[model samples]
Target: IKDFLIKNKITFIEDETNNNEKFTRNRIRKNIIPVLNASIAGGLGKFKRFFENTDSVLMLFDFLIEDRLNIMKSKNPIILDISKILYYNNKLRKNLLYYILSKNLFVDSSLIESIDRVISSKRPNIIFKEKGMIIEKSYNDLKIEREAGDEFDKEDFLKPGMETLFNGYTLKITKTVFIESLLKKKNVFVFPLSAGRRFKIRTLQTSDSFVPFGMNKEKKVSRFLMDNKISLSERRRVPLILNEKDEILAVGSLRRTGLYRMKKQKGCLCIYVGKN
Candidate 1:
């Protein structure tokens, strides 16, 4: 019959009401139904037990569907609330928020707007709420600024006693006897030049090591530059050499580590800068 219906494309709906009578009679009148009726003679007890079990199963199914629907609708399953003042007044808060959002948190548009409003408010003592967190800015916590006044001139030591090799360039006589000897030679040379925009060399020496700011440990001149923040422009203009042990001996605009240490110890072969 099922095959025949399918072949004919017959659409039919089963009438559960017809089966309901048979099902109830089997449990109540006959008292021969399974588990719910096996030990109970009265129909009420068996029916009640059957209804309870059925309800429990249906309840579980409903709960699962509801949970799935909720998950689908929620932007952030684990909602977070931050105080408006805290969010706007502290850079750390902004960084933390960016980190959390980057981690795929379900952040809402309101939360973002609230953060912006707090940040842009004219008064420092602004307060607002976002998500479940309350943010309040404390006026007292505002960063204090120092007044800029008399500016002391930085003594330029690379001026006197140095011969001009290139335009705006000079080679000062270093206290290092070996460097002085090298400088005196036609091939060996020194050019007082700036390092990259962010750095300046206070000393130069025959042997030095630099950790390259972000790298693990001090590396050779070439390795440090390759690993660190050296720009192509600076690298092209800068001069660096390695010692026999493959250690970085000198880097333009950055004091050689060995030379800096030696200068601190008041050792030989140290150079000090004086005003031009």
Candidate 2:
């Protein structure tokens, strides 16, 4: 390219740093390239061919990994069965982990090794936290999630028939005379009519404690979240439904407080949780 440009008498600006030996890249280009070419026949051509082949292999590897991830995603969007990673060779396994995690955070070899160790342990409810990201393994399932950070502190109040958005979830409270027996607890919270029609929607707190729905004994909110396999950072984002007294009525789309359990009631208060 340089010879062609000179032969045509074309003028082009050049960066002066290319000739500076103080930089490692400049030293490699000015010093190492000539030495390698002089030491072996067709050395430059060989090196170029090697790099081209390596890039092709890497592209194919990435495609295969992506195909596997897409199949896993089709089964479940949140939790992934990562046990299959154990079947891959160490280098390939680490590279695949790096590829998957790099989508969420800046990952290095050391971080990948640490996560690999955690996965190999096969212990139930193992969690590895680093740089605002949590890599959790619950038996065979894996969860990679970012820490809620300051976003968890954002709170709002919910009223009957009024929809409010909080942390990517849409919540609406309503009083209903008819109780739906098949309500999915993961998306809706049903409480007794006495629990109040209006509630505050906020993330979990350190001091929060309540008797989770279907339980008699009171438990710390932190412990309850951990029991559900929620990581420390993720627990901060789990919405808690509270009444006028600031008492927790439910863990929001999770389990409701036993205090609000409807027992032969004519009507019930329902809070529907949906993703925006």
Return the top candidate by lDDT.
Answer: 2
lDDT per residue for candidate 1 within 1-276, as digits (tens), equals 768888999997766664453344432333223323343356446566545765444443334323421212222232333332242234444544443342232244566556545555577676554443454544523211112223321112222122211112222333222333433443332322222111122222324455443345676565566565877544444433332333333454343443222212221232222222
Candidate 2 C-alpha lDDT tens digits along 42-92: 667776564576544455444445553341342212345566666555776
Candidate 1 ranges with C-alpha deviation above 4 Å? 1-169, 176-218, 226-228, 241-247, 263-276
- With a 3 Å backbone cut-off (N, CA, C), the pairs that clash in candidate 2 are none
Ten-residue segment with the worst summed lDDT in candidate 2? 68-77
Worst 10 residues of 1 by lDDT: 152-161
Error of 2 at 217 (Å): 0.8
Q: Number of the top candidate by TM-score?
A: 2
